[model samples]
Target: MEQAEIGLIGLGVMGSNLALNIAEKGNKIAVFNRTQEATKKFYAEAGALQSQIIPCETLEEFVAAIRPPRPIIIMIKAGDPVDQQMELLKPYLSAGDIMIDAGNANFRDTMRRFDSLKDSPLTFIGMGVSGGEEGARHGPSIMVGGTEESWKRVEKVLTSISAKFNGDPCVAWLGNDGAGHFVKTIHNGIEYADMQMIAEIYGILRDGLKLSAPEISKVFGNWNTGRLNSYLIEITEKVLAAADPITGQPMVDVILDAAGQKGTGKWSVIEAQNLGVAATGIEAAVAGRILSSQKAERVEAEKILGLPDTLAFPAVDGVAFLKDLESALLAAKIGAYAQGFAVMAAASKEYGWHLPMPTIAKIWRAGCIIRSQFLDEITSAFTKDPDVANLIVTPAFAALVKETDGALRRVVSTAALAGLPVPALASALSYFDSYRRSRGTANLIQAQRDFFGAHGFDRVDGVDKHHGPWGSGAAIY
Candidate 1:
């Protein structure tokens, strides 16, 4: 029996782990790296795992070793390296061969590559691999953008290596051109908003109540048992509770407040602005990171104008505070998801992808870095109404917000009174309020438009008139 052959280029963290995963699944793998030492190390580690892998000395040797109808996965850097790798492989690749780029390349580049390779018999796929290093070793959520014919040929391998989300494999053909990268970009955006919201909660607990990291961690752990449970929150609790190896204090205290952001968060915010979708949570999160990086300004403020000391909430009702915090967190989380979904919807329409929103939700339920119970509700929301404009406006979700909004407001007000920063969460609630009350501002907007555009105005009874410069109303002829 002839064995299936797969080759992986660029033995970096993600590539090496993914190569091991594929080899462990009983397929023969030909691994290549720029440095022979790195390739040898991968071979050693994978060999220890009893994997069936062959480390090739050269790209030519690797290509010659692979079997016919070859599927070669490229996991190198996104930009020029991807093109260079493709150029190197193009000569060795035969007709009907497959090439998959699993890096975080820009969608435009992917589209360009797709067009460039169209005339050739060789197949190209722009695939999105999520869940980080751990997921790469185990199973990550995979998004492929290519022809159905190519997807069919490699579907089994993808399914085997993809994480199971709600009993289905997390890998799927996300339409043609740039769909995979587009979805992954939005996924990272959602992750940014989610992480920021959790940080805001931590700030609220630490600053408002003067609680230690462990105390706030315990609260998060408790919340994990309910609907508020999520991957981000779960990881946050671990971060808070983890003690430093030497100092024995919580590890979070030693970490810098400034967070580094990859370009995806900025891309999402920019795309949202272009699409005219309200992505307040993600935008605020990005802005917060920028402000954190301005440490010199902050230090000057602290020295010249003393900042307020942390305030302590009354110790009489700890449970009440916890409940309020949980409610606020839930509300904020929903708003973030809503914003992300809204962006997806707009992108789908703009790009003509017709992406299945419900499927997107279901696939995000596991394996991916952003996996959470909240996705189940989002899936349910879209399943019930495919045309549902926003997740927050869904009947059940609206009821949830109605029940929790008061608590969220109270928490934000208390944080303000205590001079605590809860920027991400507060912004989420503000967006929710703005979205829900959008209908109420139509009259105000109409008046402003009449004042500027002189576009005429309509009365409450639906009578239209053009008001002249003197404010004299003239009926339309």
Candidate 2:
């Protein structure tokens, strides 16, 4: 029997689709699943395509069926399952075999796995595949972190199966070991912040402006035609317009208000804190999700304490106000991306990835949850200046902030006066404003810290740190 070019484990929704995608790319694929039934079902369903799929009932058979110096792709759940698969497949494989993980595992764990295989002849690759189930069967943006030799063995397959932006493949080798997954994590962090800002604007439309679901849906559809044209915005329009088949009510309205997370967003925020990066927009998004999860507590609190009264939403023409909301959302979106890229820059330095920011932006232009025209603009910015410390300082981006800053400030004010939560949007503006400041109020904070804990502060023109003395009767106070 001829050896299959590659092998894949797991036949779950994503895994199955990816296998088909690979086979369709004309490479013979050997496949196996822990459950024999899944293998049988997939083999039967493949029908006309079965000639390209080699089904194996055991790991030994799967390994033997693949070509020598085998490249195996694993798409199981992101935790212990990965380790278990590695152990199960190790004994059957020889030196120089490559193992590719396409799941959303934490980058730290990926690095640990990479280190564990350092002494062995085997190679490990932790890759990030974004875009949902449909994307897997067609094209998705691919981020690869692995050795040059390992990447060379499979680059053609990945590039062939990944999405293209203006005919350029969205798959690229970022660096060795956890760089791909690290970039993907921050991508999700920006996603969370982007989603929260959109939700805040939706809240302004739903309650403050008293617009109906369909009306709001139309507004979203309009936004998709301009700079905010993105997958999330396009979906928001559909979600708002959808009707429940049973109750005939708006689907979004009937759905639960609580948001559920799978931990990637939290991981991003934790890493930001660890690295001392000011990713305030991502931080607020993570916090907003946590707050949303406390549905019962929110209900009780609203009943216990009366809602505060504030100034009503402006009684301006709908078109004029929606334009402001658009500008507000655009500015916040820019801030979120700026902060996300800053985090990635820090990670690149700390990890020695030397990741190319322009390539990252190019890949994100399509086949990702956050795909947008703004990413194209970002690509242009990076192409012009690859080493910008912060995006707001770039010529193109600085001008953008100057144009939309007022709109953002206005929307934040309206949300505040209307007694609504706008954590992500507010955080974006505050972060931007804070970044532009030359002198801040931290001197007072430093003085207070010194007074209470004897912590030292640095003088602007002096070389040594300075300490402050407590005022008279400080103990009594």
Candidate 3:
């Protein structure tokens, strides 16, 4: 048999689908699973593609089945399992071979892994694959980070299997070491903010406006044809329209309110803070999930204290209010994405990756969960002004912010008065209000900090005095 062009380990959902995709694209692939039964099961299910797939039960067989200068992708649980798997496979790999980690890993871990293999001939690539299960079986947005030579070796195969937008492949060699993973983390962070803002608008429609699930579904379906046109909105329409067979209730109504997370959102916020970038929208989304998880506590608290005394929603023109909700969602989404990109920009500088902002935006136009027409606009903005201090300040985005901010302001204010929890949307509104202002209330904060802790503050005037004389028992500085 001819040696396979590529090899994959792990027979999990993502791994199996990705392997089938590679084989379907006419690239002969060797696949291995830690368990022999899994490898056998996957090959049996391959059907016509079985001829193109070589199933191996051992690491050595897997490695040997691939051609020289092999590129092996390890798709498995992240953290220590990844480290252990790499250590086990290192002895089998020859010089010039590449090991690619395609899991949702922390960039710090990715950087460490790349450094660990730096002295050896076996190079490492931290790759980020998005678009989920369907994407893995078809094509996903792929972000590659490694040596330029290593990227070249695998670029052809990767490009062939990546999603395309307007004939452009949704894949690129982002930078070295952890750049790909870092970008993916920010992608997910933006996703969290997007989802939360959508849910908030849903809450307003369902609880505030007293709309039925089907009615709300129509609203989302309509929005999917407009500026908010995206996968999430399209799915929200379908999900809301779905009915539970057992309970005969709306599918969403029958489901639990709590949402689960796997730490990426939190990591995005942490890294943003570390980089001194304000990611308040992502922060609010993570907090929303945390608060939702405390269902029992919320129930008990509601029983004890009861709902807020204010009206759920003050009477308003239903037609006009619906439009406001739509515009508000768009405005808030802009803030979230701007913050996400800002985080990536800061990371690119800190890590010296020089990550291509325009390319990142271009690829995300398809395949990824956050894929939207809006990202294409982002690509244009970055392509024009790659070094713009903030995405919000760009000419195109500035006009959008001006156009939609009023709606966001109204919706957020209405939600507040109605005692509705719209934390993510509210955060976006505040972020915009703070960002656009020439001066802010932080001057008082600076004085307070200097008074309490003697932290120096910069003078707006030419005066060199850094501290104020607190007219009390405090010493003057």
Most lDDT-accurate candidate: 3
Give the Cα lDDT of each candidate: 0.83, 0.91, 0.93
Q: Tell me which of candidates 2 and 3 scores higher on lDDT.
A: 3
Error of 1 at 125 (Å): 1.7
lDDT measured at residue 274 in model 1 versus the true structure, 0 to 100: 91
By TM-score: ranked, best first: 3, 2, 1
Model 3 scores worst on lDDT over the 10 consecutive residues at: 468-477
Clashing pairs in model 2, backbone N/Cα/C closer than 3 A = none
Top-TM-score structure, candidate number: 3
Over 4 Å off, model 2: 463-465, 471-477
For each candidate in turn, the TM-score is 0.91, 0.97, 0.98
Summarize candidate 1's per-residue lDDT along 185-280 as a digit string, tens digits. Answer: 888888888888788878877866678999989889999889888877888889899999989989999887778976888888998999999899
Candidate 2 C-alpha lDDT tens digits along 231-340: 99999999999999999988988988899888889999999888889999999999999999999999999999867677476666778789989999999999999999
| Steric clash pairs (candidate 1) | none
Residue range with the least summed lDDT across 10 consecutive positions in model 2: 468-477
